[model samples]
Target: MNIYSDLPDSHTLGLEMYQLISDLYPICRSITGDGVRKTLHVLQQFIPLEIHEVPTGTQVFDWTIPKEWNVRDAYVKNNQGIKVIDFQKSNLHLLNYSIPLHETMPLSKLKEHLFTIPEYPDWIPYRTSYYEENWAFA
Candidate 1:
């Protein structure tokens, strides 16, 4: 096989890859959500794809497929009613597969559910609860 002839130029492929990343960066993707479907559809344009459907409880050997999880929106607002951690701006701010929650609580109580990395003030932390029924801001 002629590897050189089969592949696009490195520079061209790099640009295409970068463009694909740019197009997908805004999607609030998780283990299962419309964002994932959108991403797959985008890639479907470039190659052939065969999708498979498996029920949430289906067992494969010793493992069971968990529920398809998706989060619509999540945020934490200050007492003044201003959002301090808005998931809409950056989906990473919310914990992945977090259970739905909407409530008002004191900072002491809310801090229990707020995860962070003090070392990196500018970067949002990534957290998830695929097995636990819980909620938190990352």
Candidate 2:
């Protein structure tokens, strides 16, 4: 589309766009929730916006909108009750749509839900079970 064709392709513009990406990177976002609202609010500062709130269960063609899902905060603590992994540090550490888990489980059992990128050992992976009821760590 020739919509944004008026925008320049200059290095300064690229840097400004990068800044916006950096600003949005840390937000814990999902397909639905306040994170999405917070994101749109941020965008409004740079552009005109007309926000629309679609209720849960609203039918859009053959699909039904699911309930809004938001994670105020999530973390996994060790046996000693010390936080080992947190969503605040990296939102990708928590799988999307993970139900609240606040119980102690054996590490071996927990490993079944924990995921990793074997090829890229240094990187944390992102997983989702949006259409199903499941939970995991990344």
Candidate 3:
């Protein structure tokens, strides 16, 4: 299947919308409680929304909002334990919903879950966890 078709365009209009969204992006925004409330407040100005929030441990369907994955930083080190890539430098460097692992592993073991795009191997692919436990570079 061609996944690129599902990707958003990076053209002029798309870029403009992206810039607008970026300008309004609230980093460190929590998904529950006040964070969500504040977001709804801002969103209401654009489109009225009835706010509803499920607490941290509530289950719905086959999924539950996993404990807010608010990561401050993460990174990988080489065999010598020297830092290779740091999440503080770029959030995409760490896998979202990763279980806060800090130990070092050989490349072979880490490769099992790592993801890379051949077109942009160095670029971190946007990955999110809404249902399952997974960790990956992409």
| TM, every model | 0.87, 0.84, 0.58
Worst 10 residues of 3 by lDDT: 26-35
* Global CA lDDT computed for model 2: 0.87
For model 1, residues 71-116, the per-residue Cα lDDT tens digits are 6788999988999999899989888888888799999999999887
Q: Which pairs of residues clash in candidate 3, taking residues 3 or more apart in a chain or in different chains?
A: none
Ranking by lDDT: 2, 1, 3
Candidate 2 total steric clashes: 0
How many residue pairs in model 3 have overlapping backbones? 0
Count of residue pairs whose backbone atoms collide, per candidate: 0, 0, 0
How do all the candidates rank in terms of TM-score, highest first? 1, 2, 3
Model 3, position 102, has a per-residue lDDT of 62
User: 14-57, model 2: which lDDT tens digit per residue?
Assistant: 99999999999998888789999999999999999999998988
In the predicted model 1, the residue pairs found to clash are: none
Q: lDDT of all the models against the reference?
A: 0.84, 0.87, 0.66
**RMSD (Å) of each candidate, 1 decimal:** 2.2, 3.8, 9.4
Off by over 4 Å in 1: 1-9
Error of 2 at 4 (Å): 14
Better of 1 and 3 by TM-score: 1
